[model samples]
Target chain A: MAETRTRGRAPTDPPASFVWTRRIVLTLLAVFTLVPVYAMVSSSLKPLEDVQGKFRWIPSEPTIRPYIDMWSTVPLARYFVNSVIVAGGATLASVVIAIGAAYAVSRYRFAGRRVFTVTVLSTQMFPGILFLLPLFLIFVNVGNATGLALYGSRGALILTYLTFSLPFSIWMLAGYFESIPRELDEAARVDGCGPVGALLRVIVPASLPGIVAVTVYAFMTAWGEVLFASVMTNDQTRTLAIGLQGYSTQHEVYWNQVMAASLVVSIPVVAGFLLLQRFLVAGLTAGSVK
Target chain B: MTSAKVSAAGAARAEGAAAAHGAGPGGSTGGRRRRRLPGKALPYLLLAPAVAAELIVHVVPIAVGIWMSFKELTLFYIREWSKAPGKGLGNYRVAVDVDGAIGADLLRSFLVTLAVTVLAVGLSWLLGTTAAVLMQERFRGRGPLRAIFLVPYALPVYTAVMTWAFMFQRDNGMVNHVLADQLHVTGGDRPFWLIGNNSFWALVTVIVWRSWPFAFLVLMAGLQNISRDLYEASALDGAGVWRQIRHITLPALRPINQVLVLVLFLWTFNDFNTPFVLFGKAAPAGGDLISVHIYHASFVTWNFGTGSAMSVLLLLFLLLVTAAYLLVTSRRRPAHG
Candidate 1:
């Protein structure tokens, strides 16, 4: 925001020739960022032999075979559906719950409020993988008892995804909600509204940016997360992250198809971020700070 | 004024109720009491769902996980609906001490994780701070540079990772191609970037590239928050740029620096996707990290017990490292509230 005042360099700042040199340097740095992504696209477009063969900037005989083989050979579409369903559901549920909890924590003081805050903070400290064994045991036990084993099921993955998203969402939104002026809520209440009504009519609508940021964070974690998705679900319900792993086998590894599938899975998240780039930066910075 | 108004209104009701009780035992207390209780209970009721979800989704799993860690647990035996065979500390023994089974992959995994965390955090801090300082200058295109630098952090794991893998491919890879062609180091033959010992640095490079942007964003903000007057005043006092950085920028950004390091350490230590995706499955035989090892034990062997045990050990190792870091850092400076 302070950048407005510092947009252009002064005439007395540096020599005129140095301007081109600076531009060239900046372009080179930008290339460092783009080169890897370009290579990915190029490799995905090439045939398997071309990718594995001698070095070529552009594929010697570029073909759409990898993209074609990606869909036909792998269960990538199914994995995408599973990822969508699981991540979508978790993000929705976590956002709603986070909004409610954050509003209460931010707007009111009650007994054990400090305890609640500390617990939420402490939850992020433990690595999610630490829970894999116990969770597997619990899921297995529940499955046995109820005749509905969640182990390797889509439900298990959904549950695991929540462990990361929900804690983060609550902490982030609580910070955002605390920043909203309490006068707004008090005014809403004065206008013949109860707490829930005030939140719905006032706070929720006002805090849209923070909520959207949390939603993006949640969705990204659930959709792109590999550790839990890989551990909790097996072949039948494999998410895209795990399905990407299936690109290689005992003998031959299909590098081209793997890159293609990886691109397919990554597109939605990248597009979502690009669309919401402004809000993403704002939301993330706000969440990280007080 | 509003809070005073609300408190006055509440006091009036309370005083009226007290007056009623003082007047006689004739007034019905239940209705007035219920109103007071609901007004107090509403916030808690709204928070109940989140608290319950956290309990069920996070705390319960951790509770059960820690309990299982103490006992020898298996999904297969549980599938048979048999009671868990309790083997106290056996899992921990094999997991921590290695016991000469499965070689030293677990230990190697721990060391590699530590190395990656240290390298990523240290380099990112150095680069990010430098970038933040450079960007802070009244230069053209600073705004666009800040936005473009966030491209990697904003990238989806799948897309960024696919791109990274493409760049680091052993043969016909873009990086090696560039190294061979324009750089002219290899006489136009491709260099192997992802094979043998090269896999370690390759993994490190990809992880650093994808993650440094995150540190950059944080450091940039931290830098911007500082008052430029400090720099101008210090410059007038004849402090060199390096001295100004050491005295003013470094000390001022210390809190964020610690947090960034800790976060980068924890996340990188737990990272699975970067290395797993970059190297593909079966990590060049000897290059397996702990997360990859856990995947192998659980998925490849279908041995949940060993997997669980390994996870428990990994957790312990991370906790120790985190503790040591905290101990050392906190000792350097008194704890901040």
Candidate 2:
């Protein structure tokens, strides 16, 4: 693609005038995309007074006070830790299990392959809200029957998030695994590897980009979850999704601190995404490599 | 690498010999191996954990939800939900009675959600597709622009929506500053965005901003698979940019778009967080999305039975739409997955 762009122009190329159009369109779209991001970042740096006043393109008096204040305001550290544990655990479990299931769906045909595929795909259509009440009931019932502590527990949150992440993980990783050549893994098997061995030795290395994409996706979904976190967690077990609401109280809302914490929490996920985004792009578009 | 390959070869022969001897003892494996059964048991073994998790997490909840819909479970009976009196679809009856208060509100919420979905999904797709097509061409600042577009998607949902809430603040938000002060579009009156009819547009804007990037990412990925030869061939035949896109790019992206549109619809329609966090306890009538309505119906009102019944209907409606969509789209072109 770089070569194509740098090479001589042809009739196949878009007209020279189209370049301006492209730039203008890209610029407009980029601005549109960055508006809220600008709001978040700019507001984060301002003090509460500045944020509550008229919107300023540039801060009148910039301070890191909000960043310092946010932790005390909300028990931000605890929420961050809880979010990391639950989202991380769910992502880890989902990705590992997804890899195996995806490899199976992609490589070997089984008796219930269609059933499994359809079931996973259709689960996407079920709204979390639709099942929220019943799922809460299930957690309550299971807790009652088996003496398991589910309510207001991080483990329960992890388990609940699985419903959201797993179906997509399996479906997406299956597509990724499908795009990979069967010959690579088959060669590993012929060279004295078991199914698991071939997967680790051959497929894993080959599809690292795809796997990275799935991992990032699963992590992000679990990270940003709000609905279940609100219901399933208490003050002790609250994730950032619900915990962020601590910025507001009966009479006051510290908008600056909220924005500061928002950026603070967003940085790691964003950095991770930006760093691995090349692989993510590669993974998503991996189909035509062969 | 060389030593590993050499050792692997040696191990293969050793393992082959071991397997031959073991085959006699493992009598069940011989018949399966002889016929090249395509690792029948192996696939199931790999799939077991995921399938089991899905059953417990997704499948069972759906069953329980269905069961909950039938019982007249309310605030009083929530503790003993299992033992709640069976209403035998009375909940369903109230939910569908469009002229009745409960049903009327639900119907209005559904319409609002449908409108939001149509506009948001359609705009998101268009913007995403356009950006994707433009980004295909390598240019100066392309990399930065691409990254910028994805920032919304990468941001946490709460943070993103909360930021939008700040932006939509009537008194001092960037939105009002731009429209009222900077641009003089609203006659310098800072209209209430988080309340009244404008809340609907606010909801759409935030949703579109967050979601379009997903469509962009997926569409861009799908665009990669379209062979450049097709584009070149069309260009040689005097096809302009629009024609080339319509004939080649859009058609080539059909399989991707089908799933993309459906997923986008589901996400937008069932979106609970955007409306919830954006509007505090209850959404304004104009912006009342069904997910929030159903949530309030059940948890807020403590009418579990009505909530479950409404949700069951939602599930069935979604299933019917999805099935119909698949059927229609597949009839036009074969399903990929």
Candidate 3:
């Protein structure tokens, strides 16, 4: 990796003052990052009343009751399942579709290549709310016309998330694929492999880091999404974002349970992201040039 | 991956190869054009889903949204939005009229969003650049520190914002407990964070914490490209650490920084999740980002026409800003590939 070239310290040994400054800055930044997280985690462990009246650095009576009660309190298990299905489905579909489109852009040039590229790039800048109402109307209309249940279905959420994820994924993956040398794919083609075969065998294996990075990103975006979930989802399809927000709005907000549920929901993605963090760094390094 | 990093060199080779092999048909990746009858249709077939997805999700919806904006499409006409009577500029007029209630409120949210976007993006970039540079040096425990630094980014957005909302509670929140009780920064009385003026900073806080790590990651990737030789040369020429950073590091990172800063700006401006999760449907006046504000205008207020008009204006403003930004940046680096 090009990064290995610059990993070590430069020829000069830094002065003590520079070392101290770096330590202080890094420490301060890390504290800034971790304190709120600590607040959330510590608060989640406290009993209900303990989190309601005052902020305690340490819970006076530490308990896991919030974790125990959070599921029963709001059907949190159901919402978690819904989030997993919707976000996971969306990520899978986006990656699969984006692989084809990104390969098309990076490895071939069609007549509308620049148009498709520019359109996807600019489309990213539009806010989600711009399309929410019309898309809702379209969903409703389609459901009415075809009886497909497009408005309040989990599939609807997946489709909407694809809207959010697909374009950017194509744009990004194309850049990553562009960074990969073209000779490898050519060599595969010469060995009696077609485009799909070359893409699957050579490009796919070589760009695992980029694919994983995009997959995690798309999943996280859908997982925590609030806007579309609020409107597109119904009682049966409530995702964690809407479910937790609804829980917090209930009378006598259960701060502890809400925090507990949030923690439980966050851990999977956080752990997955941390485990794959190195790939993301390498992937972005390859794509960042363009 | 390293073997594949020949985009710059391979282009020269690709041209030579293309000429030698005789360009039968063009647009091949690295080799000369391969025009087998079956291969000719493959790229379009591959791109079909992407184009269709764009049309159905983005292009069609945008066109329909524009049509709705020009009509009196409110809750009354939501079911049959296509039949909503056209009002031409009536919806836009109400949205832009400064003295009118809706327009004034919309203007306030826009300004608030502008301020928050500026502060958050600037601070995130600064903190991220600082951390990336600091982390560039080889040190013990750097890996763990980098992971810890990215925790906010990795954590669910709702989780982080909800934590802030809890922490910013008037009586029970930790912001007051630490700043007032421990540090005595608040004037005797505990100030509210989710409402009134302080909500802006509270909004900015969550935005910066979650997004700075992204900037940090990108800049760190960018920093790896800068050769140590540049730093060594500067050091031998009597340049101090700060001088080397200012002259060598900053200039080396210009291209990536341009892309990073723009991305951060766009993300922060378009961010509805933070404000929505933090303040809920009816965002406070001070922290009402335009995205949430438009959501409120359309959904909460049940005035889709006005909301759609605001959306059009926002889109236009973003496009204009992006065009101007690109033009200025390109002029500065006209030779950039």
In candidate 3 chain A, where is summed lDDT lowest over 10 consecutive residues? A1-10
How large is the i-RMS for each model, in angstroms?
11.3, 11.1, 7.4
TM-score per candidate, in order? 0.83, 0.89, 0.92
* Residue A13 local lDDT, model 1: 35
Better of 2 and 3 by TM-score: 3
Please give the CA lDDT of all the candidate structures: 0.66, 0.79, 0.80
> What does candidate 1's lDDT look like per residue over A105-168, in tens digits?
6666567665675565555656656665566667777887898968888876776665566655
Question: Using TM-score as the measure, which candidate wins?
Answer: 3
Task: State, as a TM-score between 0 and 1, how close model 3 is to the true structure.
Answer: 0.92
Q: Pick the candidate with the highest DockQ.
A: 3
Which candidate ranks first by lDDT, i.e. highest?
Answer: 3
Q: Name every residue pair that clashes in candidate 1.
A: A134-B65
What is candidate 3's CA lDDT for residue A28? 91
Docking quality level of the chain pair in candidate 1: acceptable
Docking class of 3: acceptable
Identify the superior model by DockQ, candidate 1 or candidate 3. Answer: 3
Q: Which 10-residue window of candidate 1 chain A scores lowest in summed lDDT?
A: A1-10
